[model samples]
Every structure is written in structure tokens, then in C-alpha cells.
Target chain A: MPVIEVNQLHKRYRDQVAVHDVSFSVEEGEIFGVLGRNGAGKTTTVECIEGLRSPDGGSISVLGLHPARDRAELRRVLGIQLQASELPDKLRVAEAIELYASFYPSPADPRELLERWGLGAKRNTAFGNLSGGQKQRLSIALALVGNPRVAILDELTTGLDPQARRDAWESIEQIRRGGVTVVLVTHFMEEAERLCDRIAVIDAGRVVALDTPAGLVAGLIGGQRLRFRPSIPFEDAVLTQLAEVESVRRSGPHVEVTGGGDLLHAVTSALARHQVVPGDLRLEQATLDDAFVALTGPAAEN
Target chain B: MNETASATRTMARAPQRRAPRPFRALAVAETRLFLRDPVTVLLAIALPSVILAGLGAVPALREPADVFGGIRFVDYFAPSLLAINIAVLGLQNLPTGLATYREKGVLRRLSATPMNPSAVLVVQLVINLVTVAVGTVLMLAVAVYAFDVPAPRHPVGFVLTFLLGTSAVFAIGLVIAAVAPRARIAAGIGTVAFMLTQFFAGVYLPKYLLPEVVVRIGEFVPPGIGAFQGAWTGDGPAPLQLAAMAVIAVVATAVAARFFRWE
Candidate 1:
């Protein structure tokens, strides 16, 4: 059974439809990613599942409990990390952890949790004094202190450095290993590719595509490009005439081939037959970035 | 593997855990934050007595005054300054603090937890109320010890009027916090309200010597109500003044509750 399910969810803010028809389910102990452009209703959809906002025209269930009606019960098992959420500037890190821990009945030990999150040394540090990455780590620790069955993290690593981002990914993997289901809302293609078991790409409040990292990247496989420099001169038609080649272009001494279905083998064999050896050969595999662009159209950036 | 799965299942199926009391955590956190704010501490818990001390040290203010019914001028000024304490905290400090928290998404974040977001508001109200109470105590102590100000003839009446007046001012502050779009705007509105109410409360001029029009208006305003009734005159707020304050308190609190936004 799905741990969290949102079906045909629709939400509007003052006549502006924030989410039109969002539908997906997060299976238990999986890192389900919601990838989208900014203002693409990713946060709004997750907020609905978190019971922060009620959908106008759909039903949501978490552990067989209605989000709106069972908000109190859901809160006990669903941890949330809101985008740009902040604590009081003067609050100490240890105090913050303990205070949030107090809100849960059987909370994890805050001191141990802090140490595990790499924040034990900063326990006495004031929130305002911490760097941006440290603050994000603290926010993550607070979200998990309640021992929630499901954790929803929104824009988890928007402002972190590359190393910090890796640390966060490791922490997320650890959370999943502990049997907590995670619904991660993010726009970073690389983050979704690395951490998500499956990603639902949202654009304009719609789920444009839903697939695993490799599966989504497969959508752009047919358009994969291969480029090489031939040892001997060859006509563009020589490559273009073949069934595997969609189009052929020559820029300087390089011949760029764009197509799918054994194009590399076909090009290499043709080159060998023509007594022309290809040098500086490179085959560019389709990436999640290309697949994301194909799925969501233009102007999608993290 | 089965044992691990069953353990996880049992953990998920167990009864929902909860914090000890509803808003105790929020209240405790907010109280810690309040103690760390130096400006609020000085303004709400220290400034009232300082102002009173300044007024008392003036030799001219120590003279017997017919306007005060043979009492020294400084003795009559004590309660007026106490009103200023409530206005400074309730109008200036409380509104800005709450509005900033709302602007920073603090309240919205709290809503995600099991605790009600309004718990933060309650915490603010409690903290500010305590500050006002402390300031009043210090001001009264200074008035009695340093300035030789007489105790109120109608102590019970003074206490009741003071409580009503504080609630009325805090209600107006809450309305300002609810309506202001940002912390800066809230602080601005609070400052204007504080200054205007201070003027009416006769902070700048003696209530007995004010112009008839000013005194009549002051009769309806906060601390001003206390002043017009004679802070030391021992008489409580007049029936009309008391009724107006109660009305303002109820109406403003209702409006605040209706319009307050978490973010």
C-alpha cells in the first residue's frame, strides 16, 4: 500500500490555480522526488499532502487517513521541512532541537540526533550565527526528531554547496534505510537523479512525466548525438543516407551524427568501409537534464 | 527480515505521541527569546522607573501643588508613567515582535507541527503582560520609596482599572500586528499609536492643567483614563471611561482574531 496518495488534487489561491491536476503516490521507505520549475506547484502539491493546504477538488490519504480531517493524527507521523522556514534568531541550536523533540511523544534523543546530523559541536551556537548549510542541517534534524513515518522536505538543498548537498543526500539515504518514507520536492535535476527512487516532473501544475532516473533519460535516447573526426575526407550524405542517421553535419574536420538505433556501429562500420578511420570519437549519452528539458519544455532550471 | 518489518509496523501502529501540554513548548521557547531581547527588556522592564526617577529628581516637581490637591507634582506623575509602560510594550514591542515572526514564516512553520500556530501569539501576549506587570511594580516601588508618593486610596479600584487599561492597549496592539503587512510597517504603526496615546495620557503635560478639549479626549484614552481619574487621586476610572476601555478591548480582540494571518 502507498504510504501517501494524492489523486486528482486541485488547489487554487484567489482564482489563480496553483495546482491543476496533481496525482501521485509515495510508497513506504522510498525517496519519491517531485521535480519542477519554480512556481510549478511542487510545493503546493506536497503542502496539500502535509495537510497544510486543503485541495479544492480531490482526495488525499496518508496511511489511510484523510489529510484535512486527520490533521492531528497525521502530524504525529508526518514530518515537514518548509521552504525558508526559520526559528528565532537568538534561539540556541540545542534548545531548538530539544524544543521540537518535546513536541513528539516518543522523540529520538536530540543530543544523539544532533551528533548524527553533524551538528553536535554547534549545539550551543545561536541560529543567527550559523552558516547557511549548518542551518539547513539543523532544519533536517528537527524534521526527523519526531520519528515520523513519512518526511516531506521542500527545497531541501537550494542554497547548499556541492559538498553539503552530498552530505544531505547521505542523510536522506540514511533516513530511508531507517524505514521512513520521504517525499522530496526539488528543482535540481542532479539531486532528483541521485537521491530519488522515482521522479515526477511537474510543470505548470501538471505531472508532465513520472519515471525512474534512467527511464526518464530514456525519453531522449533517440536524439543522442555522436561526433567524430574522420582520417580521410567523406561527404555528409555518406552518413546521412544510412537508416540509423537522422541528419549529418560537418563543422570543420568533425562529422556530427544525430540519430538512434545502432548509429555508433553503423557510423563506425561505414567509416571502416570507406578506408577512413575516425579519431576523437565521442558518444554523448542522454542525461536527465536533457530528458527534463524534453519533458517540461524550455526555461527549466534549478 | 520479518522481525524488522514487524518492528517497523508496530512502531507505525502505536498510538500517536504528543507534547506534554498544548502550548507549553511554544511558550517556553518564546519566553527564552523574550529574555534575550535587550531592547524590549530595557523598555518594558526598566524604562518606566527611569522616567519616574527623572521626574522626581527635579526640585520643582517636589513642590506642593494645589492642582494636585496639596500633593507634590512627581507623586501624580507616577501612574501616568505606568501607563506609558503598557503602551511602550503593548503598542511598540509586542506588535513588532509578533509581526516579525509572522513575516519570517515562523508561525507558518509552527502550524506544520502538532501545536496550534496561535500558541505563539499566546506566548507573546503572556511575555508582554509579564513585562508590563514588572515595569508597573518597579515604577510603583520607586514612586513610594524615592519620591514619597502616597499609596492609592482606592487600591482595589486602581488594580481593576489598570488590568482593563492594559488589556485594551494590548488589544489595539494585536490589531495593528494582524493588519500590518510587514514587521517594519507594524513597528511604524505601533510607534505612531504609542506617541499619540502618550500625548493623550498627559505624558508631556499634567492632566489637571491640560486644555479642556485635551482633558476630555484623554478621559477616553488609556493610561489617560487612569490619569484623569487621578493616578494617586485613589478614585478609579469613571464609569464612562471604564465602559469605553472594555468596549475597545472586546472589539479590537475580535477584529484581531478575525484578520490575523500566519504568513
Candidate 2:
């Protein structure tokens, strides 16, 4: 069974609709990504699922429990790392994990959790004294202390440096490997692409697309761009006349080919027939970044 | 990474697993944090007693005075010191602590746990109440033992008055905690309230010297000094004053319940 199911979820702050219509299901152990822009309502949706906010419309079932009515039960089993939640400045790292552990019926041992999360050395460190990456890791560790079946992490790496972001990605993958379902809410497409098993792209309070990283790129803006320098002079029609070639353009000594449907094999065979060696050849496909922009549209800039 | 998963799995499937008590853990953790702030503890626990000792040191205050119902000023002022502690803590200490928790997202994070976020505030209230009780007792003991001030003649009245006044004043503080959008604002408002509360309670000056209108108006407001003072004096806890305290407690607590937000 899906660990979390949010159907036609709707929420509003006053008259402003924060989540217009959102729907998805998190599989038992997959990293499900909720990809969206800043105001695209990803946080609102997850907050509702975490029982922090109630949806104005539609129903949400987390571990087969209603988020609103079964809030107490759901909280016991669903670990949540909120976007801007923070601990007291004086709270020590180990104290925090141990305190959260007390809230669960059966929780991971704080000492073991600290060691595994690489926070054993900083166990006595105050929250304010910790570095940014350490704080993030600590929060993630706290979320997992409950030994929850599902964990929802929002804006996981918004302000971290690149190195910290990489480290966080590894932690997330590790969490998934522990048999916990993960819901990752983030505006950073790179994060979703690298870590998420399947991403639901939310745009302006709606799920615009839902698929794996490569699937999102392929389904939304599916195509390949081939760039190469030919060893010998060749006619443009030799590539353009073929079915896979959409257009042919020459920039300096390089011929760029844009097409789909096994274009690499088709173009390579055509070049071989003409006795032209394709040197410095590179094939480029649209990334999740491009897919996000294409799906969210230009309005996301505002 | 493999170590991380294996460690987590092992801990999860460990034998002898049982739930840790949340309330005790939160209380212990909260007390540790409270003790870390030496300045706040000093102000909350020691300031009242120090002020009482200062008043007791006044030689003229030991003399019987008609202005203070023919009793020595030390006797009357000593009991009212408890009221002062209540106001300072309720108006300044409690509200700031709770609002800071909300502003810092501590309350919200706790809400995400199985334990309700309001449980933290409850624990906080208990801690503050206990602190005031212990601090005020110490303050009173020093004055009684050192300055020869008599102990409260009405023990039942003293305890009742303290609980009533604390509930009323802390309820008012709850209003500030409920409404303030930020921690600094809550502290700012609480400080202003504290000043106003002290004025009515006659902290800046003795009540006999204050204007009739100020005293009359102060009777109806929080920390209701009359009830608090009466409890400490030989004969006090006037029925009218007790009723007033009860009303404030009920109404303010209701308002706090309606308006309080976790985040």
C-alpha cells in the first residue's frame, strides 16, 4: 500500500489559495519528490500531510490514517523536518535527539542515532554554535529518531553550500536505504533530480508533471542535441534528409544535430556511409532543470 | 552510508524497546535550559527576596504606622513582595519564554511530535509557578528570620491567594503570548504590562500615598494586590477580592485558550 496518499488536496491562507489541487502517493520505500517553485504550494501540501495544516478541500491519508482526525496517530509514525523549524539555541545536539525520542512509543537510541548521523562528536554542542551543515544533519537525525515509516523533508537544502548539499543528498539516500519512505519537497531541481526516485512537479499550486527524473525531462521536453566536428566535408542533407534529424546547423567547424528516436545510431551510420568521422562528438539531452522551467513556465520568475 | 542504514535498522529492531516518558524528559530539558540563563533565574528567584531584605533593613519601616492599617510597614510589604514576584514572572518571564519558543519554531517542532505543543507551555507554567513559590518562600524566610517579620498568619489564605493571583496574572500573560507575532514584541508588551502592573500594585510607591482613584482602579485589575496583601497579613483574603481574582482567571484563561497558536 502507498504510505501516503494526498488526493485533490486544497488549501488557502485567507482568500489566497496556497495549494489549489495536489495529488500523489508515496510508495513504501521510494524517494518521492515534490518539486515546485517557492510559492508553488509544495510546502503547504506537505504541511497538510504532516497534520500541521488542514487541507481546505480533498482528503489525505498518511499510513492509512486521516491527517486531520488521526493527527496524533500519524505524528507517531510520520517524521517531519519542516522548512524553517529550529530548536532552542541552548539545546545540545544529543539533548535534542533524546528529547524527540521520548515522544515516540519506540524510538531509535539517541546515542546510536548520533553516531550514525555523524553527530556523536558534536553531541554536547549548542544549536547556535553548530555549523550550517551540522544543524541540517541534526534536524534530519531528529526526524529519523522516531524510526518512522515515512519521513517528509521540506526545502531540505535551501541555503547550504554546495559541499553541504552533496553531503545531504548522501544522507537522504541513506535514509531511503533504511526502508523508510521519503517525501522530499524542494525548489532545487538538482536536488530532486539527483535524489528523488519519482518527482511530482508542482507549478502554481498544481502538480504539472509526475515522473522519474529522466522521465520528467523526456516527457516534457524530449529531444537530443548532437554536436560534432566532421573529419571531411559533408552535405547537410546527408543528416537532414534522414527521418530522425529535425534541423541541422553549423557553428564554426561543428555540426549540431537536434532530433529524437535513436538519432545517435542513425546519424552515426549516415556519417560512416559518407566516410566522415564524427570527432569531438557530444550528445546532450534536456535535464530536470530544463523540465522545471518548461513546466513551471515563465511566470515562476515573478 | 551503509553504516548509517545498518545502525538505524539495528536500533529499530532492537529488543527491550519501550517508550520514554515525554513529560519528564521535557521538564528536565526545559529546566536545564532555564538554569543556563543565570540572569533570568537570578531575576526571577533572587530579586524578590533581595528587595524584601532591603525593605526590612529600613529601621523606620519597623515602626507601627496608621497609614498601613496600624501594622509595621515591613509586615505588609513583605507579603506584597510575593505579588511583585508573580507580576514580574507572569508579565515578563512566562510570556517571553513562550513567545520565544513560538518565534524560534520550537513549539511548531514539538507539535510535529506525538506530544502536543501546548504540553510545553504547561510544563513551562508549572516550572514558573514552582519557581515563584520557592523563590518567594526563600525571600519571605530571610525577612522573617533576619528582620523578625512574623510569618503569614493565614496559611490557607496565603496559599489560596497565591494560586488565584498567579492564575489571573499568568492568564493575562497568556494573552500577550497568544497575540504577539514575534518574541521581541511579546517581551516588549510584557515589560510594558509589568510596569503598569507594578504601578497598580504600588511597587513604585506605597499604596497609602497613591491617589484614591489609582487604588480604586487597581482593585479590579490583575495581581489584585488587596487579596495578595490580605493573605500575608493577619486578617485578609477578602471575599470581594477573591471573587475578583476568580473572575480574572476564568475570563483571561478562556481568551488565552481561544487565541493561543503553536506557531
TM-scores for chain B, listed for all candidates: 0.88, 0.91
lDDT tens digits, residue span B122-169, model 2:
888988888888887888788779877777778888788778878899
Clashes of each: 0, 0
- DockQ metric for all predictions: 0.44, 0.77
Kindly give the stretch of ten consecutive residues in candidate 2 chain A with the minimal lDDT sum. Answer: A215-224
What is the docking quality class of candidate 1?
acceptable
Interface RMSD of 1: 3.4
Off by over 4 Å in 2: A220-222, A231-237, A241-243, A274-276, A298-302, B1-13
Q: After superposition, how far is residue A230 of candidate 1 from its true place, in Å?
A: 6.9
What is the two-chain DockQ of model 2?
Answer: 0.77
List the per-model TM-score of the A chain: 0.90, 0.91
Each prediction's RMSD over C-alphas, in Å, is 4.4, 2.8
Taking all chains together, each candidate's TM-score versus the true structure is 0.90, 0.94
Candidate 1 residue runs with Cα over 4 Å from true position: A221-223, A228-280, A300-302, B1-22, B227-231
Best by DockQ: 2
Which pairs of residues collide in model 2? none
